[model samples]
Target chain A: MGPLIPNGIITGDWNFVIAILVGIAFGFILEASGFSSSRNIAGVFYGYNFVVLRVFFTAVIVAMVGLLYFDYFGWINLSQIFILPTFWPAMLLGGVIMGFGFLMGGFCPGTSFTAISIGKIDGLVFTVGLYLGIFIFSESFPLFKGFYNSGNLGHVTLTDVTGINAAWFAFAFVIIALAAFWVTMLIEKKVRKKITEYKF
Target chain B: MNTQTKNNYKPNYINPYLGGVLLGLLVLLTVYITGRGLGASGAVKSTVVTTADAISPTLAKANAYMGKFISGDRSPMYNWLVFESLGIFFGGLLSGIIFRRIRKPWVEHSPKITSKTRLIFALLGGIFFGAGSQFGRGCTSGAALSGSATFALGGVIVMLTIFGTGYAVAWFFRKLWI
Candidate 1:
């Protein structure tokens, strides 16, 4: 009944078109939620604001739970979904690099695009840098190919590797999200009080 | 207060939780429609491949990673992520227009750092993020959000590492934000 493209229900050329429409909604929501602002995005780490955390964690949990429901109700074939393959060492290293980048740049690729649309010079520079980085990686591919392919774990899931049920993981995520929301609210209040000029 | 330089615009940001719910639903809809989820970095990757293929097809094909994207029937520009990312750009523009948030180019930085310093870090950050996305197989939205929604183990790892590392290095980059 769903996942129309993969199931032969929504055949042919419309798949990519629909992908664009969905991506538009995704981007619109991100921008409207203050994701267009690098300062707001960076606020999650600084305690002045937690919009990024609130939106990100909530969205993840909701999608996780929704996927479970879809599978349970037979609304979609969960098995047909594409899962990102895991390379443990690469992920760990990549994540660290990205983390450093995020703190320094205040915007990720997606958010930077939104920021650029609204005329942020920093966002534009960040994107140019992204291009350069990709170029460098391509030219130096032979040097790091070994580490990139290390710890290949196939396309495993949390349930697959942890032996825990998806429902349980979702439940744990919900609890953690709620707690973070509570704590961040307190932190934001404290941090905002100390600042003099910035207004959200 | 310098009234001339300041852009007096009312910031009407949507409620964060409601926005999150909408984003989550979008993710769910994407899965239901395409048997996958949302992504951002893949679009940039496509651009990189397209540019490389044009400069030197032989060199592009020689690199194993670039070859997969180059050997495709049409140009890499015709890829799904590329089309979707275009929509993302337009969607963001539409939202900015509707919200009246459009402004002249400016850097958002702390009082401590000069605009030049902020821009420099931003470029450096982008470099690290681009390279890292390749290694991790995705960025925050691609690897962390979409991958996590599907319960992928790599998604969890990427998510943990990104935020974990952010907190670890946030102190060093404190002047950039706080």
Candidate 2:
């Protein structure tokens, strides 16, 4: 009933059209949330702003819970959904590198695209960096090929690995999100009092 | 020069919670429709593969990484993520136009740093991020968000590692933002 493409509810030719529409929605929402500004994005760490945390956590929980409901209702088959494979070592290394990139660049790939659209020079530079990085990786594929393919645990879920049900995980996330939101608010008040400029 | 207007200006961002809900729904819909999550970096990877393939078919085929993506009958540019990224670009443009946020070119950074410095770092960051995404199997959107929503263990690891690293490095790069 769901996953319209694989089940033939929607044909392959419409894929691009759907992609464009979905992407537009994604971009609009992201930009509208002030994600176009690196300063705004970086505020999460500085305690000046927590929009990134608020939005990201809420989105994840909502989606997580929603998936559970959808599965319960039999609207979407959970088995058909794609799960990103767990390549532990590669992901850890990649995540660490990406973290540095985020700190220095202040924009992730999607956010950078939105920033670029809004005429951000930094965003454009970041995109060029992305191209160059990929180009380098492609050229030197053999060098890190073994490392990339190592530590493959397949597509395993937290519930599968931890023996906990999905619902409990979702509930725990909601609680953690609520706690973070409150703590961030307190931190923001303290931080804002000390700073004379850079109004959030 | 409309000083009053400038001084009184307040940004028009939607509520974080509401935006989150919408984003969540969109992610849910994406999974429901395609049985996969949204992504940004994969599109760039496809372009790299397609471009290299176009330049040297033999070399592209010979390379272990590029070879996996190359299909003898078709082009890599025809992949789903590439089209989706194209959509994202247009979508962002549309939103920028609608909100009147599109403007002259400028670098966004802390007042402490010059535009040139910011741009250089941005490029370097993008390079690392792009390369990292290839190894990580997805970017923030594809791996972290989508993977986490599905309770995928790797998703949690990527998410924690990224934010953890961000917290660790945030102090050193404070001048760039704070």
Each prediction's number of clashing residue pairs? 0, 1
Candidate fnat values, all: 0.79, 0.79
**Which candidate tops DockQ?**
2
lDDT of each: 0.88, 0.87
lDDT score at residue A124, model 2, on the 0-100 scale: 85
- Quantify how close model 1 is to the true structure by its C-alpha RMSD in Å: 2.0
Query: What tier of docking accuracy does candidate 2 attain?
Result: medium
Clashing pairs in 2: A24-B91
- Candidate 2: stretches off by over 4 Å: B1-9
**Tens digits of per-residue lDDT for model 2, B31-98:** 88888888999888888888888898899889888899998788888877888787777777887888
What would the TM-scores of all predictions be? 0.96, 0.96
Number of backbone clashes in candidate 1: 0
Model 1 Cα shift for residue A16 (angstroms)? 2.1
